[model samples]
Target: MTAPAPETEPTPPPGRRERKKQATREALLDAAFRLFASKGYEATTVEEIAEAVDVSTRTFFRYFASKEDVALTSQEEQFYAVLDAFRRRPPEESALTAMRHAGTLLIEALEVDGLADERMSRFDCLMRLTEESPALRAGSMERTRRKNDEMTRAIAERMGADPERDLRPRMFAAMASTAFMVAADAYRMGVCGFGSFSEAVDAAFEVLEKGFAEY
Candidate 1:
């Protein structure tokens, strides 16, 4: 369990209006997932999702840019969170160590926090939806591809290495991304006797650290 340092600044709570806005966004997201799961992603419409939440089509656009955007929202959130975490790690830690901690820390927070159960349930729906829709999977991959560059640059800056000259940052970024997905899937499937999502993530990064000697 990663405990917060006393000196680490706490994130201020969102204002009442922001909380209300977030609630509406979540409601719209849940409604979209439910409709997508039932009606098929290709068949689901933004208007239908808004109707499910008793909101208008224009309101849906206010929250999500498009139907695809809503479908990939949770995933994109995690990616950015990981990047933020990676950037915040102590400077002395190696890139891989920093990434592993960053990834696992975020996953652990997700499992332990107040919103844990609800977010995980949402992730479950998203995973199943992704498997069923080739378009969603492709869209997700494209987003990951674009986001990985940001992660690679972050890692490069941490190491004070030239990203254009050194490939290590790119490798670490790609590996961390893959490890995150594999760990989440393993935890969700629960076939390997892992106890939590963070445990799965820790194990995934350990294999990389050891150069897969155990495997």
Candidate 2:
């Protein structure tokens, strides 16, 4: 089911005004991460993020509801893309195989977008914030569980299983989700025996997949 990455072209901006708004939004996202990285996520206030971008706190709220919201915005973008990628996987593949490929696309996309590097990435800041802040980590855990459930539905559809009656899809989805997270963390800690995060994730899935047969 795993195919090459999709190459969809981006649409041109509709007009100058919309482009300007988008620029502002992008600037805010970048500025927020920079501030969160430099000043500490808890210490960095919304006002600081707004002021860093030469905008009012009111304008900041216009773009993002809260600090946590801005912190998660980039992740939200990638999460949806992974879901879409899951739908593109070949149907003949088992749910676990399909998920192994689609799920790793999360890391693949990050690498392609030039955000997977430990250095020289705003996402690094976001990751650090999520790791350091108890509140952010709690929110992230709940968010991950919800997103995993969404993947569970996709897995059920691919496998032609009744989600209401079948528990296998959900279990497979949960395993894939945990595997990806563990792999990414291992890569971050330089213990995954891989150069790339995507490879780390693949290795994690491979090792995890071998477990049930042993027992």
Candidate 3:
């Protein structure tokens, strides 16, 4: 009699594998942020983050370069979410209107109890660190520049204009970026007496929609 063939392990579907990786990445980010918020970003070592997630340091590195990378994950996600929201807005809406609405939704999402969770609270701590750490601030600025370029192209698409040749899209993007920065800085500074970041964003967008005519 012929020997029975050996059984082979079946491969997981691509979608299942991708979801597993995403879950691991999210776990690392959660652990890193929790440690950073409690112990301070500068003091939280990659080893600790990995240990918190019950993974090796090498596994942490596979998901993120450093604590900063993990800390910024929420912000990175928000930026992309805003872009996606903008794309879904009615084509008839003006760029400024679409941007304002998108920004509003993003900030509002952060205020939701379950939706924001510990990840977002950690992001708040990271934002505070950025205010004091030059290194983190520089990294944030670079990311902002990239987001601006993306928004410029996106705006150009909405307007049916060439991003390279027509300055309108770039100009609008710059203005929107500045407006958001102003609101965020006010919230970070705690001088505006605003109840939430969403409130500040709403006020800033209102000003933009009005073309600063009141001023």
Sliding window of 10 residues with minimal summed lDDT for model 2: 1-10
> Per-residue CA lDDT of candidate 3, range 1-215, in tens?
01122234676667988998988887887777677667777788888988887889988888888767877767888888888878877787788888888777766766775454354466577777888778888888898889889999999999999988899999999998888778877776786797777778778888878775667
- lDDT (Cα, 0-100) at 59 in candidate 1: 90
Superposed by TM-score, candidate 1 places the C-alpha of residue 55 at a distance from the truth, in angstroms, of: 1.0
- The clash numbers for all candidates, in the given order, read 0, 0, 0
RMSD of 1: 2.1
Instruction: Please report how far candidate 2 places residue 107 from its true position, in Å.
Output: 3.4
Candidate 1 lDDT, tens digit per residue, 1-215?
34342236788999999999999999998898788768888899998999999999999899999998998888789889878887888887788888888878887777777565566677787777779889888987798788988988998999898889999889878888888788878877885899887888889988888886666
Against the unseen true structure, what C-alpha lDDT does each candidate score?
Answer: 0.83, 0.78, 0.78
Give the range of the ten consecutive residues with the poorest summed lDDT in model 3.
1-10
Candidate that would win on TM-score: 1
- Candidate 3: list runs displaced more than 4 Å: 1-27, 38-42, 113-120, 131-134, 188-193
Question: TM-score for each prediction?
Answer: 0.90, 0.79, 0.75
